[model samples]
Target: MPKARAITIHRHFIEPGTDWNTEDFNFSDVLSAQGSSGDALSITPNFRAGAAPENAVGGGNLVDIFNAAAEWWERAILDDFDLTLNFGWAPLGGGTLAVHSLVAQEGTPNRETEGTIRFDNDGSSLWFLDPTPDQNEEYQTFTETTTTQLGGGDINIGRVYTDPVGDAIGRFDLLSLAKHEIGHALGLSRANRSFRAENMDFDIDVQAPRPFPGTEIPTRNGAHLTLNTSLMFPFFVTGERKLQSGIDILANAEISEFNNINLNPVHVPEPTSTPLILSLAMGVGTFVKRKSLKRQSGL
Candidate 1:
């Protein structure tokens, strides 16, 4: 029998066209949220002491975005196990945003047990912490535009539907960052043999059109995808809020399938549907029903 091992992967901040670098990331344990079904995957978040403050931003709290990030993944994967992750704030050297540590059995198909995700809190970068607004309010909301030089051209990276609208200039999107880190914590990494094998299987299964003949795809630091605009890309552009793309979702599904875990790729929500999904998760959608029942005759 093979023993389970822990692997750590670091996410670095890179300027366009620059080579990827390495750094550290952290996590802790505290709150837990269950999915709609018993078989749905659940994530438990633990915050470290005096790490990052629970500052209020927009009309919501800072931790709300992290919770939202967790929920986003939970809705996409349907597994019977709960993943406990520790999160914290730390100085992760230069051009590093976060780090992820995962524990899994060493085999052709690894089964993940738990993981940790730490964000850089070294004060070297500015972060935009804002709650995603409801879908109905998206029309009137706006975000300040910012661009990064990519492919010898300037590309807009700003995102909308964030509270304190128009204030995202020159800052990193915390929600997108959290989602990316969570993706790593969920076993989406090239460093894991299972992930590598599963990714190949995914490409074969989809008959993925390749620009070149290769058994392995191109990646950044052997952990992030470089061929596509994926959330797990090596560089996170400033003012950009990247959501999980179809490829990203399918890649995660492949790894989950390798571990015998069920996945609901079709149920993955778009950005506009996030607020509604989270509301249902927190039972806010059922509030009126619960209140009405309470007002009815006691039984």
Candidate 2:
């Protein structure tokens, strides 16, 4: 690794979709608190017979769940960068990972497809679209949302980005998606690979060879797409999520060049508690289904 100047990468978490409390207070106290529905409160894991459960059972917020996701990944990838990365559900200068409301972008009626962030031509800036700011607007950052989880479906499919591992039920897991997209935003792209950057080696792992039925793995060169996979494997499998061993190294290398930093910098979120250091069964989504991310779309 070559040495360069250190740079600070600003990380913004945008929530165009549902959000937790704009600011944190008490979660448990909100149940039976009040409402237009006037329904009684019960935070059981099962779905109740009304809009209340779908909208406000337990009053759990995806925003806090996402915050925790950022926290886990940030802690996991802090080895090589002199990072001052900040993660928040606000509009800061740094690149953003946004989630928008369905009505905002006139995007697609399909709930299954959420594109990644849109970047500028210079590759110097990017922001998310959705949670429309106005009828004719592109986006409204962090719109007040009330979308909550209904847990206990195909928990492993990675639909909801908030479900935790070993939990009785599941929702979409956001760790892998957040980490992967952030990786792209920071400097993981086909362009960098084509540019002959060392990190793009895509090396194959021959040392830690695995038995059949094992998750794909990558070495320093490239991966045997069929044999093993990593976090950046180009496709996310249902219930799948885990950072590859070598992906972080490439991140460090790329950021070193992009920021002219002594190291490549990336940010996850700082954990408010002990995190589960386990791999998720990565998911397959519109973005992951594509053979590769667009030349520079970053989506």
Candidate 3:
């Protein structure tokens, strides 16, 4: 059997539908080099109910997003290893042989009480989106999230971008947001540093252990750290296009790997070689056939 070569992305938030534009992520770019160099990888899409929010237990009847995400990975990329993604609820359960877990953190009770930061009206405020429930707002406070295993299970998607009122204010795109967090959950640095060239100085430590101690993953990509290019870039995007260049980069990484396997550039035989080989073999057969026919005819 052929070696497994592919990363499968499972969408846990199917009900709300994903804001992700698969074309934008360029899921084939990352696999380009792999295909060209012979390290082929492909992408499989898994659509399931991976949302396992405690709130979803009621008649809400929402599927266990977290458990579903884990199962998606096990079924999709566990054997493939390129990478599998989940966007919804929290990720529980540990890793399996056939899947690598990728999920986003959803709830944050601690963040709501401590007050969070936000950038609006051309200014940055520390106490603007507080813990009080207002008229237009539903929730408040921002939590410090980390990309760690939940109960020794898979790593939950970390919410580095703090916007308590985003959904209520019609600002946050959950699918887009989850995609960004998923990137970090995979391997993109979890630092607070925004990928933008300007705010590159605001670094958040992503190294160390669970609590996100002191050492942060440097914004600068060195031998140890790699850069992620998804609009889900560590910070936030509030522009008209609302499309970050990083999203393309992240998508490209996946795309590149996928294209490699499907394209099959290396193993494909050249045009000229095919006809030549076939013609030589056919010529011998034709000659033998003519001779046999002549003998049988008694010429």
Candidate 4:
């Protein structure tokens, strides 16, 4: 039998309105590749200094929204893995949620700690650059922002568009934005050929489906993932009132599978030379016995 594997999550929510998104944004279901669920990678609900609280529209608190998002992650991933999410209210100096940690902000002055800010998606299309240009070399970036606004008579959480004219807009619920940022934290800056190298965040200037010379490649678990329904998909919320459906399902499955593999790894046998050692030991013992008998007989 293989040993059981376990995991624990420790997360601190980025102060509300922190500018974590850059050239592009990444969104994912809450579960890890294994079916574990936790708030280890979630953000706080209340707007911090300078953040516009007038934009949040959902009728719930941070705990409720986070729990709902965590459930979604749990459903997406499979069972058999340990997952936990810890809630925290500590502040952070702006950093990357999906690519790497926070870094210095240039070009655009860092916005107020918690208020409306602009996203830079102009260079995001470059993420798809291919070594060899071809007919299939195309790229696009999906970017948006979340802020508070007055809607239907009260303050609400709403998404502000960052795409250029005629570019598609992605509408996300507040919880959805947190989920997206979590994907970035997991090192998904842009979609790539395989899940093992999936960089779904917006930090890079590369795009997906580039002209790489190879057939479809499988993930570390030997499974091939299609663009649609992949946890690494760039877009999160769409239209109004619709959280990305079936996210928890994927997160749960991935987390579970990862844990199973870790808990039960394949074992390779030792070398085939062990029996030779035992045979040599028996030959030495027999020669000793014969010598002792000859000495007894005075031969």
Best by lDDT: 1
lDDT for residue 261 in candidate 3, whole number 0-100: 18
Candidate 4 local lDDT, 20-138, one digit each (tens) = 44333222222111110231222223222222233333233444444454443333322232322333222222321112221211111111111111211122211111122111111
The reply for model 2, stretches above 4 Å from the true place, is 1-8, 13-62, 76-172, 191-196, 199-229, 243-299
Q: Candidate 3: lDDT over CA atoms? A: 0.24
Provide the lowest-lDDT 10-residue window in model 3. Answer: 110-119
Per-residue lDDT tens digits for candidate 2, residues 173-231, read 23444444444323333322222233344532211111111211233212112212334
- Candidate 1 regions exceeding 4 Å error are 1-39, 53-62, 104-109, 132-164, 196-218, 258-299
Overall local distance difference test of candidate 2: 0.25
TM-score of 2: 0.31
The per-prediction tally of clashing pairs is: 12, 33, 39, 64
Per-candidate TM vs. native? 0.56, 0.31, 0.26, 0.31
lDDT of 4 at 12: 34
What are the per-residue Cα lDDT tens digits for candidate 3 across 1-299? 66543443333333333443333331110100000011222322333323333321112122232232233222322223333333332232221101113232212110000101001111111112212211212222111112222122222122122223332232322223332333333333322112222124543333222222233333333111222222333333321011222122222223122122121111111232222221111222211000000111111
Q: Candidate 2, residue 74: CA error in Å?
A: 3.4
Q: How much lDDT does each candidate structure score?
A: 0.45, 0.25, 0.24, 0.25
Worst 10 residues of 2 by lDDT: 27-36
C-alpha lDDT of residue 98 in model 4: 18
Best by TM-score: 1
Residue-level error in angstroms, candidate 3, position 28: 26
